[model samples]
Target chain A: MSTLEITDLHVSVNTEDGPKPILNGVTLTIKDGETHAIMGPNGSGKSTLAYSIAGHPKYTVTGGTVTLDGEDVLAMSVDERARAGLFLAMQYPVEVPGVSVSNFLRTAKTAIDGESPKLRTWVKDVNNALQALDLDPTFASRSVNEGFSGGEKKRHEIAQLELLDPKVAVLDETDSGLDIDALKIVSEGVNRFASKGNKGVLLITHYTRVLRYIKPDFVHVFVAGRIAEQGGAELADQLEAEGYDKYTSALR
Target chain B: MTVTDVARESVASALEQAPVVSHLNPLPSYDLADHPVPTGREEVWRFTPIKRLRGILDGEPSDARLEWDTSVPEGIEISTITAEQARELGELPPNERPAALAVARSGGAALIDVPAELAPGEPLVIRLTGASVDDLVWGHLVFRIGNHADVTIVLLHSGSARYCATTSFLVGDGARVNVVSLQDWADDAVHLGRDAIRVGRDASVKHTSVSFGGDVVRMHANVEYAAPGGEAELLGLYFADAGQHLEHRLFADHNQPRTKSNVAYKGALQGQGAHTVWIGNVLIRKVAEGIETYEENRNLVLTDGCQADSVPNLEIETGEIAGAGHASATARLDDEQLFYLRSRGVSDVEARRLVLHGFFNDLIRKVGVPSLEGRLTQTVEVELAKTVLAGVPLGASLILPVEEVAD
Candidate 1:
């Protein structure tokens, strides 16, 4: 029913030396009901790609066509893109003070659906999703992402993904700062969203540990701002066993 | 240039005995009871309009009255004091001087004290009204809160007579008090007020007030955290409609270690020739190490002819504290915040309310009383409705669903 497509995408950041490229000529597409894993080394522009696709104002999309279900995603505002069913499970989400997690999720859900959720159903849905991630119900009242531990913050991102139920999600290193237990819980939350069939996930990460839980149908290796290799789940195994030496040399 | 010249001229003038004329002594000798007129040259009065003082010699005397038929809310005790009784209290211990000024100036003033350690209750309403009498008049009140006491005093001053008011507050250690002083005077009435506050150790005093509908208002509030670990939160919300001018000046001093002070004052100016000025100075002494101080003054200019002037200064001698910051911004309605709200199905007027409510929410919620919060929300919403919804089709039957817009 829906798909997220990034074609010849290039990203950059403004620096003292003028705009410097981060993501270069990386093209990827994930149809609805598909799961795609993007593995890459640090500084390979994986997170940049995720933020750029989500329309983060801080990231500049220098060259690309990012569209969702034929809609020009790159032209949409941050909230507009989000409301269009695009979700980003940030590696390190910003801590928005005075905004509670439940409140944020409810607002996002309302914005995406263009209607208010049933209050009775919302409470139950939020509680169940939080429980699945081992989060305390009391966290609903706390400020969004504020004062949360590394593991708790990661779990919160997943909880948002589960509750908002976006049509497409960009998981940017969701397991980076997470421990083994938190990684499993986060992976489980991701798998739950994928099981919904209409949701597409672009899981970006460096390590292969999270792959053990949520097996990706396609894994793409990113190097020097572009995808260098594409294969099945065995690609994760090969990278984990042999490392990214060949891709690094090719990027050089 | 000196007060002696003004006093001499007044004493020598045939108009000296005129019904409205009040004796003016040398500047240094003028009792605090005698209202002081600014020459418009004084540093503190630089931003203030000088003409507001011209009516002092001709305005009708005030015969103000205190009307509270609804009775003071439970937990708060109120009593009146005569000028003679206050004078008997003498200079009042320097420590209690702030609260004593009100008693000293009262023809009949009210005294309010909340019991210690009692659960906070509904806000206490203190409504001061003045008859449309001929001449300048003065009223005063003294307020004291006991240890761990919590209360909100709504002081509303309104009338046609020229009114001068003085209120003094003493917050005991560990006490928490929120005071909302609203001044809405007649178009021709000149309202002058001075407030002095002394916060005890570990105590907190919050003062939020709005000045509107007044011809000319000059208000001064001086706060001092004289004991270690004391804290004070000061918020000023004022809106000057067409042809109105409101000036607010504040002085917050931190003389004890570990004391904290925060000031957030915002004003909206609209219509032709509406002018507002805010001058705030916060001093953190060297001896007041570990003290934290922050001040912010923001203004919203809603019309082309409206003007707002703000100067927030912080004098910090030591940096031993955890944090100290100050921010002041003056501009028209934020188009960004407005558009963001409007896109969410809120009409333009409702969108403005959301933005303005968000602007003041940081301070209103700090009042710590839900009922009072609701009341102030109504007050601000009404004022905003008058400005933003003016000439619009919104009727009394139109109720825009506010919902949970805070997040």
Candidate 2:
């Protein structure tokens, strides 16, 4: 019952040089029960699309309209968009030094649900979610992302995605830096989240190794801030073999 | 068997014969001639707002008194004695003018004795409440924690007063002690406080100074080892509001080999004219080899018109040491951290509350007063509500619940 629609999205990020344009007139849509993978090269603006959709203060929306179920997502604040069912699994999760994972998750859940979760059930849920990601129960007491290894940080993000249970999730490079075991665990967590049959997944990645496990229904080839081509899941395998050189050479 | 027991034989005879006092200190002396009124140009007085002292620097005697409310645990003795008796009990001499003035002007001193190996079940609470800002009180207190004894002592200040105190903690060998002096005065109050600690062999002492109120409060905690294997942890926390000055100074003198000293202080400033100063000075004498020491200070700026000065100093005379280092940082709330919290559905206001509270949570945990932790968190919330969270009620739904710090 969730539909995230992006129309002609344009984004520019602030740098010492200037507001350099990173995303240019990109359009895409993610509907319920569908997994869409946006695969591209290193500088393809794939992560930019994810962060922009999540309302990060770093990115400026020069142009475009993003809506969730016909409501203007562009008009909402970051937390408001989150409450409206848009979740972004950041590629580089920031470290919060003194906030424990359980505390953070409960706080976020309270904010999103507009009511505090029952403590007993919430603690059990958190432990279960962490265990599913191959994380220890004691990990709930650790400060968020602080001193976490690459695998731990990514796994924690997937844990949040499962617990927050938002309608539409835009994961930006959640599979990077994860080994095979971690990749499988994180993919399973994402699959579990998307398997609800009512949630939309916009899985953005640089490689097709993760796509093989998650099985995306649609694939968009991203190049120079725009989608150069579109196809089914087989396009991910093709990109993995042939790479994005063919897509970038035409523009060069 | 302990040095304290031997010192009980004769303080003058023991100290005069020890020949262990480091030349670098040069500040602790019983003579009033050794301490002079500062022109605010001296290293110790430069960062202080001397003019705001209102003649306290003159060291004039005052008969004013702060009403005391005490919770005396079992096996502890609190008695009034002369400052001369305190000195005879082996308490270190006053270092600076305020402390020397406190010892000179106060007619008598309060002495609390925790007998050898005695463990108190509850914290010995000494709550002092001043009647008005007009009261200029001089305080002298001597605390003697005996060998192998474990104890926690809390000294809380509130209401209004110009109070100057020279307190001493003489911890005996193998003793474990946690001393917390909380400066929660009224807005009009000014306080000049000092704590001089002599940590015995293998003893561990944790002294915390927390300043959240007062017009001008400058507090100092200085430590020196009585013998080797002594460990001292000095902690400080402060919050300065508009037009308020809160200063904390620490000096750790390692005159004995194989000793350790660690100092960590965190502060927050908000509103116009809010200022805080932290000076951490560690002096390692030539004989003090194989010592480990580190000092750190962090400040969070919550508003535009606030100033936080953090200075860390380490003077090592000997090259043969285990380790020595210092760190300092002053910054506003991190933007990326805010974005991460907000993207998780925490509102802007709540995210800020979490970050600011989180900034102090770790240090409060280190404060080690379990009963006072909750109250400290609430006090921080009230301080925040003054500016950054203005118009937000203490019970507002926007204020996130303070969680138990796990670190």
Candidate 3:
């Protein structure tokens, strides 16, 4: 079984004024067959944590370390970290006009698996994944994320997560910009993937609406780059009703 | 050592060899010397480096051809156009000759001509090999697209050679033609070439050019939307390495109303002194009301010493045109774009190639010829790998070597 462990990880971005801390110190771990949710308000470093863990160049690791199954993940390059069984579903996936989503997903799968998949099996797998996401097969012909509606983009990410099937998945604000129908469909796809054997998920979001559909095994509150509170499903419900007003005041 | 002296000498030599030559001939009237170095003064040479072109003016033209590999598609017929054949077709009225013609004499060169109205299954391929030689050599290709016809032409240059070339094309009324040019020369050659096209009424012309080699190269293309309702599209992509300089000058004239012309050129430069330049000049004449014209040039400088310069100019004499504008931007690779690809398990080298391929995808996919576009993509990816991977920060691990990265 694989596990993604973040040990007191802190991140900062090199701005014109110098390094400004984004994630103060985020520590969490998600083991195989588990889905963990990190809920926080705007600027609470939720997305920063997602990007930092995914090895995005803009997010610098100021301190601490991220490890995957005993390997130092933070020391690995972005793609290396990814190939080591990790994935991040970006909130604002870029519109790559020349590459089709099918092409991108297959290429990613090959990179992770170190070889091309059997043609018929790969086709069937891709079709099944797209169907699960309620996407047309024609989406294979369209450029990756180009001109896709907000809902379509989210579904496309889920489609990738389903097709690639990484050991660990980091979904960064995947629930944003999605309608209720889209959210339900997207959640269903996530649920299906989460049920797969030996898979881990780090679900980052600000709202509890998504948690209602794909229940997270653990819920953590992120504030100023660190996890300030840890609890279970009821914690998400409490935040949804009471909000982060209490957490913000306590952090200050 | 100015361009004028060289042009004058070339023209004088041609005159001495021609039996019907006259001292008062107005056909070669555009004197390279009399015209001030095109310093963004002319609308056509605006986006290109006016000063850097000075290096090409004094350099000796040679007939040198290197022995690098050449790739040409199979099945397409290839033939050289003879002087006799050109004479039989009649002279291209004085007004139709491009300014580059003053240096291109008819007898010393060979021309590739694709038959009118013939659509071959594969692209007509022309491979020009050059090596270091003292004498100047000229090559001309005349492509005549007959009414309602369509075809594709691929031109590849490889080897160590220093020479200048001229390509002239004419599209008959209502004809459509697509031409793709790829110049993948040895890293140690000097190259200069010019393209001049004439579009007839209701004719459509599409041209794509990719440059990936040579020590210094300057290419100029002139398109005349000579007839009403004619459409012309000129797209180009180039990658330059250290000590290399690439320049492009484009001219589009909307000579009639309801005509359209679009130009977009993008380049990536890396290494020390890798300089790239783009100059676009468009003219919307008084009679060209309702003409639609757009020009855009974007560049990516991936290294500290690399440089890119772009200049766009629009000469609109009337406000009747529906659209006329130009856009030019130069920036480094987008970190976000790279991160997005890398996060998908694509190694740094592969990730960069994917992003670059995507950056040029809009144009390559538009080439409309799958095999040809695929080959060009490979050619550019190879060139980009040499410098892009080398520039990566130390201690940074990459998934594949620059050469191993594929699209």
The order of the candidates by lDDT, greatest first, is: 2, 3, 1
Off by over 4 Å in 2: B1-26, B391-407
Expressed as tens digits, the lDDT of each residue in A156-186 for candidate 2 is 9999999999999999999999999999999
- Candidate with more favorable, higher DockQ: 2 or 3: 2
Winner of 2 and 3 under lDDT: 2
Provide DockQ values for all models, in the order shown: 0.08, 0.46, 0.34
In CAPRI terms, where does candidate 1 land?
incorrect
> After TM-score superposition, what is the CA distance of residue B358 in candidate 2 from its true location, in Å?
1.3
Give lDDT tens digits, candidate 3, residues B128-199: 777652334445556655566667777777765555666667777787788777777777666667777888
- Model 1: per-residue lDDT, tens digit, A88-165? 887776654445566566766776678889999999999999999999999998766679998898898888888778
User: B142, model 3: CA deviation in Å?
Assistant: 4.0
State the weakest 10-residue window (summed lDDT) of model 1 chain B. B398-407
TM-score of each: 0.72, 0.94, 0.83
lDDT of 1: 0.71
**Model 1, residue pairs in steric clash:** B60-B134, B60-B135, B60-B136, B61-B134, B61-B135, B61-B136
In model 1, the runs with Cα more than 4 Å from the true position are: A10-22, A59-63, B1-36, B39-41, B47-70, B74-84, B87-120, B128-138, B144-151, B157-164, B170-176, B182-192, B199-206, B209-219, B224-362, B378-407
- Among all candidates shown, the one with the greatest TM-score: 2
Candidate number achieving the greatest DockQ relative to the actual structure: 2
Q: Proportion of native contacts in model 2?
A: 0.52
Q: Tens digit of lDDT per residue, candidate 2, span B210-317?
A: 999999999989998999999999998899988999999999988889999999999998878999999998988777899999999999887777899998888876
